[model samples]
Target: MGKHSKPSGQSGRTEPASGVRVRPLPVRSAVRLGRPSDIWHKSALSAVVAMAVPALTLFALGRLDLIFYTAAGSLCALYGHGLPYAARARMLLWVVLGMASSVGIALTTASLTTSAELLVVCASLIAAVHKTVFDAARLGPPGNIILTFITASAFFVPQHLGQVPLHVALTLGTGVLAWLVCMAPALLRPQGPERIVVARALDAAAGLLRTEPRADGVRPAGVSDAWHATSAAVHAAWRTLYLVPTPTPAKATARAGLERLLMRAESVLGSMGQEAEEADRLRAWARGLRGGGPLPGVMLSAEQDVEVLGVTGEVSDVRRPAPCHPRGVRPVLARLAPGSPLLPIGARVAAGCVLAGWVSMALGVGHPYWAVVTAASIYQANTTLTWQRALQRTLGSLLGLLLYTALLPLIHVGHLAMIALALACMLGAEAWISRNYWLGSVCITPLALLLAGFGSQLPARVLIADRWIDTVVGAVVGLACCVAVTNRRAADRIEVALERVAAAEAAASRLLAAGPVSGAEGAREVGWARDRLAGCLAELREAVEVASGEWWQRALPDERIDHAQQQGHRALALLVRQVSMPAAVV
Candidate 1:
């Protein structure tokens, strides 16, 4: 469904040597959005609880003027949803610190210069840097976009040099509280995140199995997409388990069970051509994992007879002694260089924010940062995704404005009531954000309006009017930027990615061709090759998908991508079999 078919020679493209026509598989559109997954619910809950703590505390203390700062700090909780407890702790710590730094900088800049133009320039630069760091680190959801929104919006908040320290402290203090809230769930279920990851992998594998095959035994369309997703989930599950700082006895046992499940999933993929009942078994196991029940045994007697290799524990132990080096600023700056693929995206974001902010101020909007945030929200990996975001943001904001108008008079009755309503909207926004950006935007719009009006008590009508105006201005400006700043290097990136994948596949194929290895050094080499091939395949998939979505891009190397992916999956399956039965290959 994501791809389209057109006659191969329609655009002056040569036909293949077989003398048969082939269709170029171009992406249908870049605007594909999916429903909310299970993890999204957890993220929404964490955000709500985290924000409520500081929000209600400040409200009780009659310090409602500081709610914006607290809300800004609470945003730190929205990150690291997929990480293990130990890894999550480290990520959240960095996120909270980063949020505090951004807030401080914004407030300081506002105090130093009353010029809106200067503020826009500063915010734009910060947004670019924030986007760079977030992309480099691959810090998942509530990603750089939301962080940029919070910091950029802070630029418009009136600030004084005397009050800067107090506000920064408030943000830092509440940020710590938010961090605690996000991590607190780990105590209740230490292995919960890992379990979720394995469960998702199992579910994805089952989905692949359920796809009907064509007469030639090839899987149905979109099977590649499903396989890609399943592979990612499996890889993430292993990484999460291995990265656990210190696993308790129970967690260790759980980890062992998950390892077995992973092996079973790989076996299913290896035996995809056969009509096996393992698909149902995998689905049942997934359900059991999600439901926290005892896992059922594999029904494939012959497959089960294959030794469950001690691969998981050994790999983790061998890797544990390695020192962890934090990524340095040099690499991040290098990524932001003019020649980098992401450079164009970051540049567009900066330009859009600056121009949108200028337009908002020129139009005398009360909150120009609203326009900046909206502009930031509309950017995605490609122009098509950006277009989708703009539409979703505009629609969501309009509906959100309606909801805000209806509830504003009621909320104004008391400060506590307004705070409560804001919290509720924030919770809803997080809940719906994963389902659809527009749905999430509806909640975010009102919540933002409420928070913006908290200390100032701007009239609801005025707030609504300004928001509508800003939304249009930001969306228009952002879309214009998308059209103007095209990623000219998208096709070139796909070719580079294909070369990397080819190299990785060749290395892996050589390892398999050599048969089972003896000695630690040989085994390590094999394992490294397998891991490298897997990572390269994932990168290729992402690169192609993104490039395919760009407007006015050259035809993608669809056949090359498909062939590399198929070879990569086959190599992985062979590696899995070899690990289980070391002598089988030879």
Candidate 2:
């Protein structure tokens, strides 16, 4: 057969002459905005309460000079939103310590260096390190950028060597308080975060089901997009449940129930006829979980019950043992070595920050660190995201400035009153942030201004003018760096990830084909392969997303990657089925 012609035995279309299976070009949506998330209220409430503790304490003590450090520490409360309690506890502890360490470093460095140039360099390096470490660990949103912002901003605060210990103490103290405030919700609702994960999965599954062809046989516009999204959500839910660290009997039971619910959702995906009813049931269960009420039991049909039973049996029998991975300094140090994907991001961030700082200083901005922070905040995993962020930051800052101007007269009433207004803005910013970056910025801009004026009163006009100028400067400098410093390896990384997925899927496929061995050793191998395949798929998806966002890059192997993923998932499903039926495997 000719290269472009289908082979005689093949049932599908032939590959192209060049051996590329090109897909239709992706259409760019005019509306590239995100919807409001349900967790916004929780996140906003957490920030307000966490910030309030430090602000109220400092206000009562009349130590406004130390308020910034305390507030900086309080920001630590914003992390680990969807993590299980055990995981969240560990994460929050690290965050608080990390926040304190950043403050300590800032204070010590500021004391040693009076030169603005040297301080800017130190801050840039710190920002780079923060970016690298946070990315490596996958700490999620309100991520290392905020930590860098707080630390870099601290460097600009006038500090005496004698005051270092006190400032550090304030940061540590408030950090501890913030940790406590974040953990407080666990007392009332121990499984809230985990339930949220399940709820999200259910909602996503419902969305996927809704995209199925109607009874009249009409197809929807974005059914393929919806399927991909739902797949991601289901996988996320499984991963979340897997990592839950359920040490107690009650927690373990809850975890198992969540697993069953997820399995049912998956089965619903496979059998499209009952999509709406199943979707509604899943949503109802999700709502019950969120409301802290009795879970509405989903009555499965006989076949579904059998499927659920088999899945549960498999889960109990061959759940993979968690692997021992390097922790702490080891993982962080590993990322700094040559060829780490995170290294490029770190380099870009450092360059952007240093250039922004220098430019801000040249412009004689009163707070150059603000410009530096703005620049640091704009660097996402790829240039496209960076472009979006720069736009969001600028637009948000502008609106925020307007809000600041309107609130300035009211804020000028008293220091305590300003603190109250700042708190309100903090609440608003957090509430709106998940909806859209710009909306969040509207509150963040005014909140930041209020925070800066904490210890001393500044002329509102000058403050506003400087912020506006610095914002534009930072946005321009940041976007320039993104264009100049590209992650050329992003596409290559996706290729490598695809290879890993292929390997993993092959291993699992071999196990499924080989019939179950009698010993634990075989089960362990099968489990490991399954876990590795899942991880690789997740990594591949992330890499593809990042690569697709790069401008002026080579055309990505989108069809190839998609084909591999689909095959891998099918192999995984087969492996899962074999696990369910040990006799068939044997």
Candidate 3:
């Protein structure tokens, strides 16, 4: 039952008002929506669009020479789309390092021997280790995994050691070209738009809370959906922040605003659980209150506090509404101001780089594919999840190799159909694997099999042996590095976030006790408290996830800790609303 359990919320209903004029509503659904980003599209285009060029280059080199490294280079387009330029620059450097290492290892292994079985086993072990360790490093998705698969079998290619530098140089060059394609023209500015987007999201959550169904009814479908949707968006914003080259003023504000919005959203979610029966019926009626227009007003102050977020579109000058609070309570809702405690950008990037570099040294020193896996393994908003990802990578790599061996003969090595199938699988894997790593691994194994065939004529048995070997080696070395490098400040971050939540709650209490409040300033303060709490919660979630996976994590009072923090958050939300009514009506 818990598996199907849904969080409670205000029911969608509307109370009949006497003497009110009823008008026929429009047939269209009314809901606020933000413009979408094209990061994925851009990244994909940057890589695959250049497919023709890679083939041509290989042709020019006088060998249908399997554009193996070209595939590795294709991933470079996604490297720095969301980061500050400096961070992106740094990441690019690391990507190159990782790629070089992967290709180097595969080439070395391939050239070192002609035994098909030995090569297969070796490649599989290295592939496993590559997957495991890179995940532990926290490098993240569209990461080095692709590169690893490509290079792990580069060993089977007939190229001599003398050709290693040339091969690596070409791959890196292609990746750089992919990177340039995305950076050439920046169309939509994210920072300013993001600020408005987050603000709107916060506003929507508050409005939903204010009109939630009463205690005796089912939650409004849309409001409940929004809760999950917003949570995901908040997470995405953090990831986007990680990708950006620099923190623009607008983005910084947006980031801060997002943190506050999350806090408010959580408070609203809690309130929905406590609404009375009257509220529930009202929620149901109101759920159908359709109008093709902007959101309902929840007045707050901070609109003119700073200059307009200069953006391309016609900027709206609407003032923010004050945050709504429940009657008869005085929680510190206003204290949840947005702050810098959300994303541990520096720590994540630094640790990720180190993990990547180490994996590169180990895998890169011999075969570059292992280094690629290391890059994929190390990325996560939470370091602990990074470790889990590493585990998944190892498991998937071993399985992938096995699957590849089984299907090898059916595909007919060096055939156009096999290559096409491989590319198709790669595309599908990237698209669907987002659901989970293992599912993606299933497809990736087959793709790798085809790619290996592109450069050599090894039979099914030999291919199977070498693939498994690379996986094991890569997984082992990667995890070891995780133990060596610890995210020392993870615990402290959780502690500090809890403290901030407490502080925000306290502040909201002080403001509400004073009496009725109104105007944008009041709303801003309330919104701020709500957002900060959300951020604290996010941090807490990350910490818990990390602690669970971290092999070296010591004992932590997780149960007691999370319980007390939630209690504080609930109290803050209720008290802020209770105390604001008197001053708010004025």
Compared with the true structure, all predictions reach lDDT values of 0.74, 0.74, 0.48
Worst 10 residues of 2 by lDDT: 1-10
* Model 1 misplacement above 4 A: 1-33, 212-218, 246-253, 274-276, 294-338, 517-526, 580-586
Sort the predicted structures by lDDT, highest score first: 2, 1, 3
Give the TM-scores of the predictions, in the order they appear. Answer: 0.87, 0.87, 0.55
Per-residue lDDT over 415-444 for candidate 3, one digit per residue giving the tens place of the 0 to 100 score: 555655665666655554555575566677
Query: For model 2, how does the per-residue alpha-carbon lDDT over 337-389 read when each residue is reduced to its tens digit?
Result: 68776778888888988999899999998888888888888888876667778
> What RMSD does each model have against the real structure?
5.2, 6.6, 14.3
**What's the TM for model 3?**
0.55
